[model samples]
Target: MTTLPQFALTVLGLLFCAGDVAALALLLTWQERAPSPDARRLRLLRGVLPASALLLALLLLAVVQLALL
Candidate 1:
């Protein structure tokens, strides 16, 4: 099987990380506008942020590994 190049993987990982950052920013902005934001919404955002971070980390690691190869 052919393997993809490192630079490509790194770029892809960065794109994913950027998306996560964007989502987090949107959530923060929404929270600021909310008048007594719903507890459930806050809880969901709490969960989403960590999960997204984890995903970004994993992708970054993959990119690094590919680069090293």
Candidate 2:
């Protein structure tokens, strides 16, 4: 029972981070034909990177807690 939240959070966080990375990769490719990426896209990437980092940190914390249990 105690493990349920930890497990769920870990899985969800990983999925979120993975999706963010994939999106960022796809967005980067969009700049290949241009001299620079659009300002809007850059702003979006900036927002996503921080969110992914925070989620990854949470996921790591959850894994550590699960291991300690």
Candidate 3:
């Protein structure tokens, strides 16, 4: 299968980093308005999980890009 070039992967990583920051801000804002501890935790997790996943994915992409080079 074809793979993305290192430069492209690097750009994608940057974009993901920006997205993660935004997600964190939104998560914190949501947490402040949450009604209960359980609800707060759930909302925080909901915001965090996807950002974490994206970070992991970006890490993997970097690794793959390195391997290709």
Candidate 4:
């Protein structure tokens, strides 16, 4: 029988990664005003990029554990 913690982890991991990916798509395709290279670099250095990277790292860790289990 599946336990609650496993089920919740699966749900939360997928949701977190999906949201992170969607945010990346939106940022990459933004049409309102194109961000300059410097602006993009600054944005990454400041917050969004690093945070997304962390999300990816966390997701990878979760998937690896899920697979081992």
Best by lDDT: 3
What clash pairs does model 4 have? none
The lowest-lDDT stretch of 10 consecutive residues in candidate 1 is 1-10
Q: Tell me the tens digit of each residue's lDDT in model 1 across 25-69.
A: 775565566566585477557765676577667657756765676
> Which is the leading candidate under TM-score?
4
Residue 31 deviation, candidate 1, in Å? 1.1
- For candidate 2, give the lDDT of residue 35: 53
Local distance difference test scores for all models: 0.65, 0.62, 0.68, 0.68
lDDT for each residue of candidate 3 in 1-69, tens digit (9 for 90 to 100): 335665676677667667756766775676779899888788668865676677667756755665665
Could you tell me every candidate's TM-score relative to the true structure? Answer: 0.49, 0.48, 0.45, 0.50
Show model 3 residue runs off by greater than 4 Å: 1-4, 35-69
Candidates in descending TM-score order: 4, 1, 2, 3
What's the candidate order when arranged by decreasing lDDT? 3, 4, 1, 2
What lDDT tens digits, residue by residue, belong to model 2 across residues 1-69?
A: 768886787677667656756765665555444555685566556754576566567656755655665
Error of 3 at 46 (Å): 10
Q: Model 4: per-residue lDDT, tens digit, 36-62? A: 877666765666666667767876776
- The residue ranges of model 1 lying beyond 4 angstroms of the native Cα positions read 1-4, 37-69
